[model samples]
Target: MNLRLMAALGAALMAGPALAAGGAEILKSQCVSCHAVEKPANTSFERLWERKGPDLYYAGSKFNKAWLEKWLQNPERIRPAGELYSRHVKGSDKEDVVDESTMTPHVKLSKADAEAVAAELMKLAAPEGMVEKGAFKGEKVSMSMGAMFFNKLRGCAACHSAKAGTGGASGPELYTAGERLQSDYIYSYIKNPQKIDPHVWMPTLNLAEPDLQRLTGYILQLSASEGK
Candidate 1:
């Protein structure tokens, strides 16, 4: 569940190459409101904006640009399956407020401007400052510890996933949290999830800093590369 484990998982998700420093500034300013390059771990999205979307902190690393440009032109249902794993389970009665119409469109932007923004966003990296080698504590998390953390302590699987038959279905599936998210952003979100989403459907439980780290570690271990 430490940083290394998560990085390992995310690395596998990098199926294709990536390029940064294109004209993503406009994209950042325009699309970043909901798709922030941040995290949401410890707070609910409701307190942050009364409405918020998932973070784009690792867009460059996780998604393909062809898909992104197409998305800008006409978004597909990425989050429609729900952030955690809506495709797998039944979500609450409340429907998501975000719809295709609410997304920012590039129609107003000149073709060049839209492309530039898309280029910049394609360069983004997951905010990882802690997934360095030798970052985990001397002791690895025992299965008991991992199990307890997953089910009892952090219970991240609720909105997240680990190995299936666990976690939540309200957010993105966590079966690959390691490769998908930047660790530093995860840390930041755990410290203050409210900063990312003011109106997140998730609840905000007061988790201690160290506990958050443990939870992050556990979540990261669910990365995609371990078996790959």
Candidate 2:
């Protein structure tokens, strides 16, 4: 090989580990206070409720890398109500409302840091067989049918919103799920949320295979049309 080519190859090889190490260091310093990089031993309801942010132990399995990278640079609220729904909720005799003032915004990172952090986060994978491969077959569902299933049949809209400023706020907004999460993770989580996080408030719906596929497709479609 030419000397110039050999030098370039050497730099590329060295950059990978260096970047990962920097990412790990950034995560430890900046993110570990709120997010769990490793799975926690204590998963009690009280412990889970006290969490400041969603667990990142399975980020690689859960999030799309490109979305994660971009989102880190310009962090936006994915969970409208807050990480712990109970904390932000204020109850009156008539109804309970989320105290938007209490919601904390995520700290944004620089472009270089975002790239490094996303790369490191993508290394935190779920255990073997946790996310089924090829679970979502890129199925397409009509907006009307998908809306019926998400809003009326499954009542998912009670917790998650299919559109911005619409539906419930207790759960993370589904309007961004397509761009934010991995397809297989979305399908797997919908199938059984507790299987992934035993203390999560989301119930096990025990949906049939077809229903699972359709719902996942609906969420993906809804997310795709969010900004447009």
Candidate 3:
């Protein structure tokens, strides 16, 4: 190899770790205030309720690397009512309403920082067996069939919306789940949310294996149809 080419290769090899370190430093300084990069030892309801943002300890298992990179650069609200539903809700005579002002937007990172951060985040994997292997087989579900399972059968629409400006505000929006979440994580979490987050508000539906597969496919299909 030419000396110049060899030198370039050497630089590229060194840059990877340096970029990861930079991302870690950025998270430490900026994101630590709101997000928990490390899993909390305490799983109390108070600890869970006081959380400012979603736990990112298993971000690698939860989020798509491409989506994370782009989202970090231009942050948007994934949860319409905010991370802690109780905090953002106000009771009315008829029903409770989410106070939009209570929802805080995520901080945006520069393009370079976003890339570095995303690279680092993708290293934070879940504990072994947290995600079931080959759980989702890239199965395709029609939007109508998916909706039937989500809305009527499973009652998922009570908390999650298949589309924007629809469904309950307590849970994170499902409209972008296809791109935002890993398919295995979705299936596993839906199979048993308590296994993932001990204090998570989501209930265990005790869904059948086929139902799990269908729900997973539906979420992916929903996001695609919405152009997310």
Candidate 4:
């Protein structure tokens, strides 16, 4: 994978909701500064970072439990361009002073605490009751529509990739999008981009609920989910 593209994907992943159960209070104290428990709109990334954290409203919908646990225990060396605690760079640093009035301290996670938090965190649910079970016909229609949506409406290819026929400077490459995202995750993102980044270039256009569904369906199907 390309370095810049990976960076874009890494940054994009940061936009999702995080699951940390026993860590819930930790979330309440340390994480909620950016994430909105109620809905995704309140949590555009840029907006949340302002208070010193990224919005984790969609954690239930986005992260892998094990990865999140490890991340909490030892945050990755890689830092998102505008991360709230970038000044410290990694989990060991103490220089990143969080304003108590705005953000909370980065308390270390205990094994039991991390597991409990991960279990609860994974339950983050979205209202997709209307979406029928079983995969929709994708391959062609989905890929094409996803491309169109990314370029014209959502403009995801921007910042993420140029092949979508539009261009952005900051995001990642979707060249193999089919190989990356899960359908459930993609659909939820289209419904609300703010959950990922309350203020990233990705905007929350007032797309009709159904249209949002289709967009997500298409994106989830953007890459093949098998034989990675």
Candidate 5:
């Protein structure tokens, strides 16, 4: 073989390991500085305040894979102010320093890398079935009724909105929750938020089954409409 061809093969061989490293390895090297792959033992506000990013222990259950893949490439700020901890703190002695604090944009991942990372993340699921009987899948709340519940009855609009760039910025945008999240996951998380994420700012509504079904149905419809 020609020397030129041999050099090219040698370079390709050298680059193989990095390109072949799996998503978990990529996450360990690139993402662990800011994110956690395991559930935190301490769920206190103070403990959460020390975290640089949201935990990824249950990313598989919490986010849609397509959304996660797209988000990794075209990153957007989910929490406008920052994580719950950064947004609530009042003084300069705050411990958590998030991307929002530095005004740094999220690192954009290549499409292939994003897909791999999302696939790895989706492997992490809740140990048990957290949703109760998967109630919201068949609930029949009308759009108007759902709107009433979201906007007035349940007061969900106080922190969450039906569309992007329209609702309160503190919480995540729910305009696409139906497409972005699993229905049962929503039911489970809202039913007992602490069970999934301890010390989260979201309160345990302890809603009755009917209300839970109605609210979940409303969110499903709202997300389906894309806030139209």
Candidate 6:
């Protein structure tokens, strides 16, 4: 099935009550204050501090439908510090003394609202083939190898945390990435983050194909272990 059509189907299949409750109007009133449905004209990390929330311009391309539905109803802190990490402080000692005022929890949605919103967000699309099938499905990497690449080789630990409630607070925690993200999306983003979010804080690393496959496989392994 064409992925874009999935969004439409989501809305159509919503429990009748959720469909009856205006989804678009609910999104506009509750979500637009923070998230952007369309691509923003600007794409500069320098101006990232001004962003109220993460862009959902290509959300349909980026997120897993099941994950999105579940997350909408039970939102969690993806970014530990804040949307603009520089503005929030955790100190050099890695203390948990972050100023809580800098961050606000996502607006909690009722099951009906979450269903409607997830449906609407899923409708947001990107260019075709952004994540080709089996793109990131490659050779498996041992946990140790994945750890070495993530922590030492790629220096990803500087921003992203490999485990929940651990590592740097600047980026989203990858502890549950495999559970939350689609492998093809992960591979495509790693290959060219700029293609995904041009002004994203994550750098564009021209990692070799082998390294990319290893990293992708590693995250999947990590998530499965966590699930156990």
**Top lDDT hit:** 2
List the lowest-lDDT window of 10 residues for candidate 4: 76-85
Please give, for residues 151-225, the per-residue lDDT of candidate 4 as tens digits: 777666545543443354334334433334345555545555544444544566777755656665554454343
TM-score of each: 0.48, 0.88, 0.88, 0.45, 0.83, 0.82
TM-score of 5: 0.83
Candidate 6 on 39-118: residue-level lDDT in tens? 77777766566778877877777777777778888998878877766677666566655678777788887887788777
lDDT of 4: 0.51
Predicted structure 2: lDDT: 0.89
Ranked candidates (TM-score, high to low): 3, 2, 5, 6, 1, 4
Q: Which stretch of 10 consecutive residues in model 6 shows the poorest summed lDDT? A: 89-98
Q: For model 2, what is the alpha-carbon lDDT of residue 179?
A: 91
Q: Cα lDDT of all candidates, in order?
A: 0.53, 0.89, 0.88, 0.51, 0.75, 0.78
Pairwise lDDT winner, candidates 3 and 5: 3
In model 5, pairs of residues that clash are none
Q: Using TM-score, give the best candidate's number.
A: 3
lDDT-superior candidate, 2 or 3: 2
TM-score, cand. 4: 0.45
Ten contiguous residues minimizing lDDT sum, candidate 5:
95-104
- Alpha-carbon runs more than 4 Å astray in model 1: 1-80, 83-119, 122-140, 164-166, 224-228
Q: List the residue pairs that clash in candidate 2.
A: none
Q: Candidate 5 — which residues are off by over 4 angstroms?
A: 1-11, 85-102, 129-135
Off by over 4 Å in 3: 1-20
Clashing pairs in 6: none
Count clashing residue pairs in model 6.
0
